[model samples]
Target: MDATQQEILERLNASGKGTVLEALDISVVEATKEKVVASMPISSKHLQLVGYLHGGVSVVLAETVASLASVMNIDTARQMAFGLEINANHLRPKRDGQLFAVATPIHMGRTTHVWDVRISDEKEKLICISRCTVAVVDRPPDDGDPLFKK
Candidate 1:
């Protein structure tokens, strides 16, 4: 990766501090204008009662990478990207190891973005496929709510 790509990856990873991303130990391992990739360890914290990876956690990783990719495509100073919708089809069950999610843009529009995210295991086995729609809108004026402001 080039310096710019490394910087983007670091920034994206740092932005997750104190959030669920940090709690889940998710980190952006690759990033570019067209795609973003992240990985999360499948620890006990991420398992269901039967010791399988929780489906919702897959969605979280999917949206997180896709939304981060969307942010990289826009000007954060004036624009914001929000997940409008996401659909995931879980194809396999994972018990341990790491889950890697790669998100690529399907459509990049002025008002919205559609991303295709494929989640796979360390062995490159497909686990889930997700398509996420992100809404791009003007950032609202700072009204003191950090949630909206950021």
Candidate 2:
């Protein structure tokens, strides 16, 4: 991987340390300005009571990859990406193995970005398809901001 891609992976892995991403075992395996690839294990932690992967788990993976893709394309020093909306269709039940999600941009705009994320199982069978919209916002100034006060 190139420096940019390596940087993206390092940053993402670090940020997952204390978040739901960590709990769900999500990690970015590859990334570029136009696309991102991530994966999560389909363990009991991600399964519904019915023993299949939870739909919400798929949505989280979708939003995560899409939002990360949006962030990768922006100036992170001054901007941040937030998921504005997301929708996912779970097409297959996965009880084991890892699920991979690949996100590609549908629209990349100054204020907003749209991405299509496809999740497939280890066998490359489609598990979910999702679309996510992200809003890019300027980072709030840190100086004297109550939210940033420590």
Candidate 3:
């Protein structure tokens, strides 16, 4: 990875503290202009009562990486990306392994961005495929909100 990608990954990992990403143990492994990759371990925390990875967990992973990719493509000082819609299709079930999600942009417009995220097991077998649409809105002046404060 280049310097900028490393910086982006660092910032992403840092920002996950105390968030769902941290709770789910999601980590960004690669980031670039074209794609962003994240991984989560399929531990008990991520499984449902049926002993399989919960569908919600897969959706969360998809949205997180897709939103991150959209944010990476925009100027953070001036804009913010918010997920507008997301859909996921689970193809396979995973019990105990690492899941990797890769997000690639499908459409990058001035007001919106769309991304396709594919989640796979450690062996590279597709587990889920997701698409997310993110809205890019101008950032309002920070009013001491911790989320908006740099």
TM-score of each: 0.91, 0.91, 0.92
Collision count for each candidate, in order: 0, 0, 0
Local distance difference test scores for all models: 0.90, 0.87, 0.90
After superposition on all CA atoms, how large is the RMSD of candidate 1? 3.4
Candidate 1 per-residue C-alpha lDDT over 93-126 given as tens digits, one digit per residue, 9 for 90 to 100:
9999999999999999999999999999999999
lDDT for model 3, please: 0.90
Error of 1 at 9 (Å): 1.2
Show model 3 residue runs off by greater than 4 Å: 1-3, 143-150
TM-score of 1: 0.91
How many backbone clashes can be found in candidate 2?
A: 0
- Per-residue lDDT value at 42 in model 1: 96
Task: Tell me the tens digit of each residue's lDDT in model 3 across 76-123.
Answer: 777888999999999998899999999999999999999999999999
Worst 10 residues of 3 by lDDT: 141-150
